[model samples]
Target: MKSTMLSMLVTLLLIYLSVCLVVFLLQRKLLYFPTPPLLHFSPPMEATKVSFENGGERLSGWVVNEGRAKALLYYGGNAENIEYNITFFKDNLPDYTIYLIAYRGYGDSTGEPTEAHLYSDALHIFDQVTAEHSQLSLLGRSLGSGVATYVATHREVDKLVLVTPFDSTANVARSVYWMFPVSLLITDKYESAKRAPNIVAKTTIIYAENDNVIPRESTERLIEAFSHRLENSILIRSADHNDISEFPEYAVRLKRALN
Candidate 1:
């Protein structure tokens, strides 16, 4: 009987150690992700480097126009360099001045990426853009939606747009890992659904009908949170998470959102 009890105790210890290892691995992933180099592309807009308040980091982006115009600041997804988005911005709206922020650790920028640092970087970029241009229109896609939402709530802006956004990282965690307690584990809480309505600017929430990563249903929940404050909202048919800009409807909806 004593031997049997000893064997069971050993098995339980092994299982606990395995679970702890898994959690440790996931925590590291939650903190830092690899950022690939910016792909070379022909931008219809003029490219420039903007310095950040943080002495070490600088942002490289495309400036659409030199003249005074409505400024559009774009924040991109986790893995993408905002430089890749220049063609979409130039083709869709040439009249406006667009600043596509290439976040630190991505697109030829210096320094490692972290949740708090990135959020602070967004504010610094917004302050610079707002100083340069009077009318500021903020746009965010996927991971950027969290950054944009945070900015909109804190700062004054003319327009706000969120593309392929989820309700919150906590909810997304629940969906992806229902068996595990991810809310307690996740460090970066990109809670767009909870924060969007606090924004007083004219807002538009666009979701792709075919988005697999952030499902259409989650965006609907996001809309419900912002329904009272949002100026306009729409769903682009046949648009997937990564390829929403490929659809003509995206441009149309965005143009309308600007107005």
Candidate 2:
């Protein structure tokens, strides 16, 4: 009976290890959820479609209200159709030109999506736009917050805004799967908290009052990490993680933050 029990325990251990390996291998597949590209917009907002080569990969996005001295670079969420923001940008931020990048694999961009490539493409876009705009700001929401945080650490952004942001992808994953060794088994760990200290840009972090996606603790930890340069942190009352952008208070608070 003792030997049988020992064998059962060993079998369970092997099964657990196998599950961990599988999670490690396919972590990115679970993390990034790319939606189909929206090719057309109704009542078009007079934005121009643009494309550039980043490491030979064609990255595509929309550029709205070009020729403004002040500019905003927007990094969108996972599964987000970035083109949906065209009208919002046109109406709310008329003074600044906005560049909304569709992540590789999410839109017309031709490349697989990963943290390394996303950060690289962001840097490329930043460099390309810097010469044209005198003052450039950054806005990142959800998964894009990771990419945006990485860019803010490396580049010279005037203002940085993170919406529904997490302290780190690994931390969030670990919280979600406490029984598993997520930290050891995950790739593309967007450790935003680790990079927050180096960011010199005036920063604003926006959170939902009832965010069901990213845990409030993760967001609070990220806020604490930015104790040095965080200009403001706002929570949109009565908003959830996905619907926060639809609220009037969100835009109002965002505009205030940028100003």
Best candidate per lDDT, number? 2
TM-score, cand. 2 vs. native: 0.97
Residue-pair clashes per candidate: 0, 0
Give the per-residue lDDT digits (tens) of candidate 1, residues 1-259.
Answer: 9999999999998887687568756764754454666566656535554445464677666676555568888888878767667667777777788887677787766776666777888888888768777798889888888888998888888999998888887676677666666776677878888886688888888888888887666788888898788777788888888898888888899988986
Cα displacement (angstroms), candidate 1, residue 223, comes to 1.0
- TM-score of every model versus the real structure: 0.88, 0.97
lDDT of 2 by residue, 67-181 (tens): 9999999999988989889999898998899998788898889889998999999999999989999999999999989999999988889999999999999998988889898
Residue 143: error of model 1 in Å?
Answer: 0.4
Error of 2 at 13 (Å): 0.7
Q: Which candidate is the best by TM-score?
A: 2
What TM-score number comes out for model 1?
A: 0.88
Tell me each candidate's RMSD, in Å, in order: 2.7, 1.1
| Candidate 2 stretches greater than 4 Å from native | 39-45
Model-by-model lDDT, in order?
Answer: 0.77, 0.91
